[model samples]
Target: MGSIEDRLRAVEDQLAIADLRGRYCHLLDGRQWPAFIDLFTEDGVFEGLSAVRGRAALTEFFAHRVPAMTEEFWHFCSNGTVVLEGDRASGRISMEYLSVMNGVSYVSAGHYDDEMVKRDGVWRFAARRLTFYFLAPLHEGWAGRPFHNPAA
Candidate 1:
């Protein structure tokens, strides 16, 4: 068994990671682009409907991609499961999203597969990949609809 300090450090790391996940939703929904990009490492990669590598490409990707999709949206992430290995970790988090697209309300369900690294005692995503089960208008629902990766 690990010592007391090790156990405590693990708890602290878990909490910090949880906070990171929450901050992602808030920053994305708030349209705080700069802060949002900061959540990832300098060479971080994001993959979903499309892919972007490094902070510079991420900046360009969001600046162009997000506004084109919708100006208003809410991103929610939950059910996070992480495996810590010293300063590195891997996790999967479930997400539900709502957005106003062309005046229509749409909902999306998905999960994020993340690889994270802790540098200088701070945790950041090294890579994040999203997979969507479905995305559809509120009136239509998800049944019989094709899955989507809506955003990168």
Candidate 2:
């Protein structure tokens, strides 16, 4: 059996992992590309509906996709479970993303599979695979209008 101190340390590590996941969502919704990139390990892979590898590639990927959306966006995460093993850990988090475009709102629900590692005393995501369960289609003619500029 693990000692009390060991158990407490494990819980703390899991809580930190959860906090990192939440920060990731916040960075994405806010379009804070640099901050988002900082969350990943140098060799991290981000596989969305489209696969992107490395931080630079992920930046380009976001540049192309995020601006195209004509909406204010929010991503909410729930039911996160983390398993830690020394320097390595894995997690699963359920999520829902909501966006409002031209007075219409759309939502997408999904799950994220994550792998992480502790590097130099800081935890960073080594890989993340986002699997979306459902995505509501945008109403027609929504793209023709100006960008929603959520940051505005």
Candidate 3:
């Protein structure tokens, strides 16, 4: 919030961060584990039902868990808001997904609370925390049930 140059930089940064989220969805849904993990910092942490820290752990977690649970999947992200502060930024993104497990259809909705850092001109997630509102099989619906892991 300063000169024209500063304002331009802010817009650019926001767009880049948005791109990161887009790529995250594509990579993960596509099961491109290595590239997906690269979206994070080396010490990045992903907190969902459990916490997976560091790129190595993230790779392991996604590679094993996602495949084990989902036969097919698609991730949709929206309602993202980012606040830039020098080299660090924080944001929230709404997420929804359709998935298939053993020929059973499922749906999930959640939001990600993200802490991101700009490192060497690229923004990467330092931490991503997911809180799900619903994770239910398509037929059963989300009402009157507790949130549970899709994998279980």
| Alpha-carbon lDDT, every model | 0.89, 0.80, 0.91
The ten-residue window of minimal lDDT in model 3 covers 143-152
lDDT digits (tens) for residues 40-150 of candidate 2: 998889886567888888887776666565457788999998889988899899988777766677666788999999888778899999887755645543333432333
Question: What is the TM-score of each predicted model, taking all chains together?
Answer: 0.94, 0.82, 0.95
Writing each residue's lDDT as its tens digit, candidate 3 over 14-69 gives 99999999999999998888889999999999998679999888988899876886
Candidate 1 global TM-score: 0.94
Candidate 1 — which pairs collide? Answer: none
Question: If both were scored by lDDT, which would come out higher, candidate 1 or candidate 2?
Answer: 1
Better of 2 and 3 by lDDT: 3
Q: For residue 114, give model 3's deviation from the true position in Å.
A: 0.5
- The lowest-lDDT stretch of 10 consecutive residues in candidate 1 is 143-152
Note each model's CA RMSD in angstroms. 1.8, 6.2, 1.1
Order of candidate numbers by TM-score, starting with the best? 3, 1, 2
**Clashes found in each candidate (C-alpha, N, C closer than 3 A):** 0, 0, 0
Candidate 3 positional error at 95, Å = 0.7
Clash list (residue pairs), candidate 2: none
